[model samples]
Target: MNSITVLGSGWLGFPLAQLLSKEFSIKLSTTSSSKFENLKDENIIPFIVDINNLNGDIDKFLSSDILIINIPSKNIDGFKELIKHILNSNIKKIVFISSISVLKDETTPLLEIENLFKKTNLEITILRFAGLIGYGRNPAKFFPNGKVVKDADTPVNMIHRDDCINIIQKVVKQDIFNETFNCVAPSHPTKKEFYTYCAKVSGLPVPTFDSSKNESNKKTVKSDLLVSKLNYTFIHEDLMKIVF
Candidate 1:
């Protein structure tokens, strides 16, 4: 079985490792020692890694056929050091989890980090996900009660956690490398419509929207390339119908 190492064991990474462990030898890293026992209980090899300090035996952590980088850190210097270690390791493929926020803002460190990986000799696939929802991350709870939410008419760009995992799995299994794909759901519902429905379903107070603002230059991210290239169907294609 091919070995795969996950750099971060958070909301998306931990569950992804669990699913991938069935077919591949999975090694996962966490900054907290509290999660070590839990990871080992699930038959995942656990490593304590802190990229900010470049701590832990990263060389051993990278001793795998594939590496999935799911951390949220944007420390360029830390990645520079990590890239040096990656260049020296046996990792053949990499899947870097990026955010769609990079597309709207050029000042984000994520864009520069993406460029850094692209410059490398190793095979890399970058997945730029939209606003992550599903499970405990409900969009309805984003704002407090009676808060005026802007962009009521603007369409929302979101992807479920399940779809994100599935997309990563497909990319790795299909050997799609040296490419970047925007991972988002097929539907683009207005923020007002979607969030109101979410609040009702969750039994939360519905948020108020600013009626004065115009819907000009609305941003809606699509996963057209990801869908066509992977030929994959999303588990939660319709965000309005998503529950938990």
Candidate 2:
């Protein structure tokens, strides 16, 4: 069996590691030793990887057939360092789980990062994901207690944890490489609509916002290529309806 190493096993990696266990020799790395037992009980090899500062030497770890990077870092400079180290490895395929936030009000960063991966010799699949909701890290936490945006009608994008794992699995099986895909559900609920749903279920008051005053513009990433290229299906189509 091929080996798969997940760099992080927090809210997202927890489920991903579990899913990969059946098919691959899975190793999960985390900054916290407290979750070590949880990883061990799941029959996964766990490591304490302090890569948050982008200092994790991944050379030895890249011996695996597949590497799934799921760490959280908004600084492109840090990510650039990690990639600089990783691109030199003998690993054949790498899946970088990036965020749609990379696309939020900033094109240059994603563009530069995408260019770095695209221009590399390694087969890189960059998955720009939407707001991850469901389970521990819920979206409701951000828009808490009577919070509202002026452009409440602005489109809100979200994806469930299951869909994220499913998409990654499909790519692994298909050997899809050197491509970037969006991993978001098709639902484009307005900010008001989404917050209202959250408020109702999360017991928070949904405050009013003059949506016309909202000037923020962002396009929710679609999974069309993901569906066509990898033959993947989303567990949650209308993500907004499913999050709460």
Estimated TM-score for each candidate: 0.96, 0.86
Candidate 2, superposed: residue stretches over 4 Å from native:
41-43, 52-57, 75-81, 84-88, 107-111, 215-220
- Measured by TM-score, how close is model 2 to the native structure? 0.86
Model 2, residue 64: C-alpha shift (Å) = 0.6
lDDT of each: 0.90, 0.75
lDDT for predicted candidate 2 compared with the true structure: 0.75
lDDT of 1: 0.90
Q: lDDT per residue, candidate 1, 168-192, as tens digits? A: 9999899998889999899999889
- Least accurate stretch of 10 residues (summed lDDT) in model 2? 51-60
RMSD of each: 1.4, 2.6
